[model samples]
Target: MYINSSETAIIALLEKIKSLEEPDSAGIFYNAFIVILDAFVQPFSITILVSLVVLLVLLFFSAMVSGSEIGFFSLGPQHLEKLKQSTSGRGKLILKLLERPKRLLATILIANNFVNVAIVILSTFIASQWFNLSSFPVLAFIVQVVVITALILLLGEILPKMYASVYPVRFSKSMAGVLNVLIKMFYPLSSILVRSTSFLDNRVARKSHVLSRSELSD
Candidate 1:
């Protein structure tokens, strides 16, 4: 009787252990699959990923403009100081930015806007195709339009601009450091492109002058 009771107790304990381990095996497998899926589906995980990439590109361009402005301002800081001393000191920074940085910023804005527009158009087109709707009904169209516009405006433009505007100095400084590293990494290719662009601009300017002279003579 003692031997039989001990054998029964052991069997019960073994069965309980097997039951607990069975659930854990499936749980582990499920967790492993989830991790793999998350890794593979990164791009689809969030709607903002694409917008973030665009924003980063815009920020990079902005950093380049800031760098160029810094270069111009530092070129003759003493001269600028003398001018500032002669005039109202308050307008000096504004004037310096207006002379160069503003133009660079405007170019960046134009590029950013163009990219945003392209993204909106492409997204709408793809959505339309995916839904297989011949023409969007009025209500559905309105909703689609609003949703798409809101996404682009909020995610791509307003949010980033607001953040940058509120913390311009900090953001610019950080971006400047990043851009410096990137420029160093790509210096060889960047130098070639810069030189080629400069050469082309000079050639275009000469041609334009010659054409203007010919037009005046005629």
Candidate 2:
């Protein structure tokens, strides 16, 4: 019953992921992942309908996150060079964000993943029941995976990324404030992710994944 609720499902997944690093936990975690998806059908109810709406809203935000990263970070050497010459506040803010590439990367990663996971969980509840695909487990899983993948890639990733690439400055400016707020709001999760990745990268490469200022400028 709890698994049918979107909020519960997201929390469950987050809790599950937190254990992924533990020894011999992969099988347990994977089993829980498959077991979380269950029916969430109702004859008619405003409350139930609202949950589905929330998922759609999350999908939209996920798309924005995908696009914002491209728009914000796709600035080239020449673009950064020109921005450095400008004295505008927005340019200064952009430069400031670029200066902390790890935080920027971590913030986008956190927001994107958080939204995307919620979308998947919500979709699992609605898709299986709405389409009556529960009768065929293999087919249902395939269909759900395919549909979600297509929607996320087309609407949430490809379209937005293309638009961001085309109008980087406009999109980046529009997204800057929202991203700044998200970075702070999700800082706890972002910070942990950044730190863990840095630790692993240093072990593997003898350096962190974080880019240097000169590297960013180049």
The TM-score of predicted model 1 comes to 0.36
How does each model score on lDDT?
0.50, 0.77
Q: With candidate 2 superimposed using the best TM-score fit, by how many Å does residue 64's alpha carbon deviate from the native? A: 0.8
**Clash numbers, per candidate:** 0, 0
lDDT of 1: 0.50
lDDT of 1 by residue, 43-78 (tens): 332345554465456444543443433433343555
lDDT tens digits, residue span 40-150, model 2? 233555655887788779878988889989998898887788778988777777878889888998999888887888888888777754654544678787867888878
| Stretches > 4 Å off in candidate 1 | 1-99, 174-218
Q: Per-candidate TM vs. native?
A: 0.36, 0.66
